[model samples]
Target chain A: MSTEPPALSADRRREVRRQALSVGAATGAYGISFGALSVASGLSVWQTQALSLLLFSGGSQFAVVGVLGAGGSGVAAVLTSTLLGVRNGLYALQTSRFLGVTGVRRLAAAQITIDESTAVGVAQPERPAQRIGFWLTGIAVFIGWNVMTLVGALVGNAIGDPRTYGLDAAAAAAFAALLWPRLRSGDAAATAVLAVFVALVTSPLLPPGVPVILAALAAVVVGLRRGGRHEAPPTSRAGELPGADPVP
Target chain B: MTTWTTVLLACAAAYALKLAGYLVPATWVEGERRSRVIALLPVALLAGLVTVQTVVGDGGSLVLDARAAALAVAVGLLLLRANFLVVVAGAALTAGLLRAVGWG
Candidate 1:
């Protein structure tokens, strides 16, 4: 196996940054909705801003606020939100392989392995592109999201009722933006349906974040059933599905 | 619950989970099965989130509120392959209209 880092041109790095910037812009806009809702859900501006800066995961932030709005316990809200954010682990693992990072670089890489970073990294044409894409997207999303959160919080405060202006819809709309392009296959569709079903069934019974965790479990089950014939594969290159490009 | 306390605890828990990814060894995460499962994780998590938000929003009630209409419009736009900004704007517009019509 080739352990050496692939050569990357300056143009490639720039391209990666451009891609990251677009994704970041979209994600950042979405964070505005989260900030608005978080405050509207009874969190102080300081609390909402802190969560945006500290947690930095949009889905988990929504889950936390959803639980809070429902009057659930703090422990329950935290637990649920934490569970939903667990996918970052998978992103970190995939990104670590491409970045070939260690020590401080490795730690930083892991910190930035969010959805946009992982997607951009995985979508790159080469390993070097992957590393650049990951870092660029991660940093971009972090910076853009925080700034947008501040904007949203200020607007939400000014507007009073966020629902009156349909601000809450932005989160779902942003997620839809992220999700639509990825649904390219039947298996993905099935997994999505199963997840939605699981969430729908469990939401009423569970606290805010737990339903997402359960949906993830359902997807895992589906994946295990479908891909059970072989051991899991290493990170596939962008534009290549599993079993599409076999390494010699 | 003390709002600040809730926020603090939630933030701490979230950071802990994010940090946990680095703590777990890579060896445990390797394999085709594991990769497939990981690939599906985001969709599953998001689906659950959407489901929860749509079905049992505030007050534990499942009403055909503005949020639902906005989500439906967003989903339609997504299916139609609209640009991300366009999709968001479409959903927001639908929601605003619904609210303006007193359906929200």
Candidate 2:
């Protein structure tokens, strides 16, 4: 991966900036729902707010809420969420190649090396704009998301008995929305269905949360059986484009 | 509370995972069959989560509750390619409305 792509003309720079801000705004506004939902899931305002600040990965954050909201053990919730965050490791591999970052800067890049930043960075044809896009989107989303998290938390704090308004259904709905796009291939669908079956069968016998962890075994089994189809060629399938993972 | 302790430890663990991805040599993690399994975990986890949230409840058994109906609505909206916000609001509305009618 080359670090010096090419010079960015004035138009290209402006175009990159606009793209960065737009991605930032969209991803940032999403933070509001996460903040609200985390609180709605029974996390304290401070704790919810702290999660946004610390964990910062939207999908993992949502997994945490979804599991705990259902009375899951902390271990199950954390393990499930951590499993989802593994993709970040892949994104990091991609980012480290082209970003050419080193020392503390590289470490910081690792910290914010999420989907949007990696996507924006990789999308750029020019090296400078790539770095710029990555940092711009990353920092912008960070500021916007944290601020909106406060707003959503305050709003969530005002609501009562989330169950009364059917807000308790939120965790389930969010998961369904997230799962919709991932069922692209027969294997993925089968894995998902099998996971569902495993959880359902185990739900009665196992304690809360354990079944969800057990369900993850479905993917491991299927992935092993599926063999070498590592990443579906980006164009060949429509399933795994961004925003499919329900961040909220 | 114990929850906070778990939250804190989880946060640290999550951060450690992120950092380790950077610190570990690429050869060890890249192109391994194990990576494929890790990649698919989110899809599996999310599907399991949907099942739990929709059918399973605090009692740890499957039940056809308002959450299930709302999830059906969400599935419909998502298949229609509705925006994320709309999907979320629609599901919440469906559940809220059903509960208002005493089904929840």
Candidate 3:
């Protein structure tokens, strides 16, 4: 693929930005849930906001709050969250080459190099629109998520005990929902089941983080055992934004 | 680690992860085994998290409480193909109702 960005007509550019803004609005609003849930999990509003501002990865942000909420240590939360965010690293591979950005701009691109941006970027038929879509979506989600996180945290804090709103189970529920998409594959489902068993067996005798760590080791074993098998390396990422191109 | 420490450390590490993506050679992560492990890691980690959060209590013992019911409800929604947010809300409502009925 040529690295040079192709020119786009005005109409297409407008359409792309429009789509970006709309998706950004919707995604930003979803930050309210993370904010509320994080607060419910006992993070202060600012702390919740920090997760949004700094980490900037959606599922990973949820993982951090969820892990900590369930009394898992920081190490566990970080490790789990890191695993969740690794896909962005993969996305970054395509993104860095495509964007051809460098210096401070490259660094900025890295900060906003999330699933939403990458998907938006990759989905565009034309190269110019791809760049625009990437930036617009990233900026939109960034502003939207951070601002709404503060709003949600305040509202959640006002609600007193999160359990009243069933927020106590937010982490598990969210993670379960996240897991659903992976269940489409038999290999993934089996890994999940076995991991659950590992988690359950270890929960009785281990620290909060250790069980999850042990469970992750199951994947390491599976990955190594199946390493030589032909599986497609992912070209896209896990960002499930509306209207983004479906990754093959 | 304290929550503050956790937040700071996590933020730094996360940024590093992203930065590493830019700096690390594609060939390293491009290998079949490494990519496979990367893809599967989240599955195992999240499954464990979901299991622990739903079934394991603070004392680190299995406890089938409101959380368990909530997860079951969420699974039902998932089976029905509900949207992600809807699944979360459904779980919350189910757990809340169960707790209110004093069944949990």
Candidate 4:
């Protein structure tokens, strides 16, 4: 048996860089909306900038600002943000295998494993491509998001009513953009539907962030069941052929 | 809570969640069951988020207002497989039209 490891050649590295740049452009442009809305939600420029730099997850930042704007308690805001951000943990697990780095590099890899980076990395066909994709997208998003936040905050401050300019919808639009492609698959579509159903049905019964968590759990159950079904005998081979060959 | 306290707590919680995944030990992470569940986690989580934002937002009052209309337009755009920018613009335009029409 051959023991040679799968290696990404120089051309593949260039392709990874290109993919990263594309994802970065999309993610960075989306950040403009977050920055504008964070400021419009009554957060100071410094506070908005801090969120972009430290929090770094667009979903969490939007949730926090949305809660705050709605007059929710600070605790509620934090909890909401935390709940939305929980997805990054999942991304971390998926991306870590591609990193192959140890010690400080591993730590750095973990730090940058957000949605954009994870998506770009996971989309690549080769291991080296995955690593390069992840880092480039992560760094690009980080720099681009922070810079756009500053710009949006300043503009939001000057404009006084982002609603009039339609800037407030930026986050939602950005999120929708991210979510749309994922819905293409049957399993993903089922999970999405289940999650929405759970959240909607349970929202009134639970506390601020509790419903979201419960909805996620409900989706997990559905996903697990779906996965279990796929693992059953006949479908096992089915999974290996055409469907599993596609990138997530 | 003070702004600093809130920020600190938020950052701490976010980091804690991130760290929890890493600390779960490679054995646990490597299991087929764990991998299957983790694969579905993001979809479920994001779906929950979208549902909450679109449906029950603010004071637990369900309003089919401008936001909802815009979201509907967005869904349509998404169905068409429109580019991201076009989809966003479509939603914004829907919202603006609703507002102009005194709907919300």
Q: RMSD, each candidate, Å? A: 5.5, 2.6, 3.4, 5.2
DockQ (C-alpha based) per candidate is 0.52, 0.69, 0.72, 0.48
Highest lDDT: give the candidate number. 3
Candidates ranked by DockQ, best first? 3, 2, 1, 4
Can you give the TM-score per candidate against the true fold? 0.77, 0.92, 0.91, 0.78
Candidate 3: residue A197 Cα off by (Å): 1.1
Candidate 4 chain A worst ten-residue window by lDDT: A239-248
**Cα lDDT of model 3 by residue, A45-150, tens digit:** 8899899999888778887888888888999888878877777787888777667787998888888888778878888777678889888988998899888889
lDDT of 3 by residue, B44-102 (tens): 88798899989898779999999998999989988997766687788889888888888
Q: What is the lDDT of residue A161 in candidate 2?
A: 72
Residue A197 displacement in candidate 1 (angstroms)? 3.4
How does chain A of every candidate compare to the true chain A by TM-score?
0.72, 0.89, 0.87, 0.73
* Residue-by-residue lDDT tens digits, candidate 4, A114-231: 8778877777777767778889988887887788779878877998776665554544554565566555456667777887888777777666555556666754575556345433
Off by over 4 Å in 4: A1-12, A98-104, A122-130, A166-172, A185-187, A202-208, A224-248, B2-4, B19-24, B30-37
Ranking by lDDT: 3, 2, 1, 4
lDDT of 1 at B47: 66
Say which docking band candidate 1 falls in.
medium
Regions of model 3 farther than 4 Å from truth: A1-4, A227-248
Name every residue pair that clashes in candidate 2.
none
Best TM-score goes to which candidate? 2
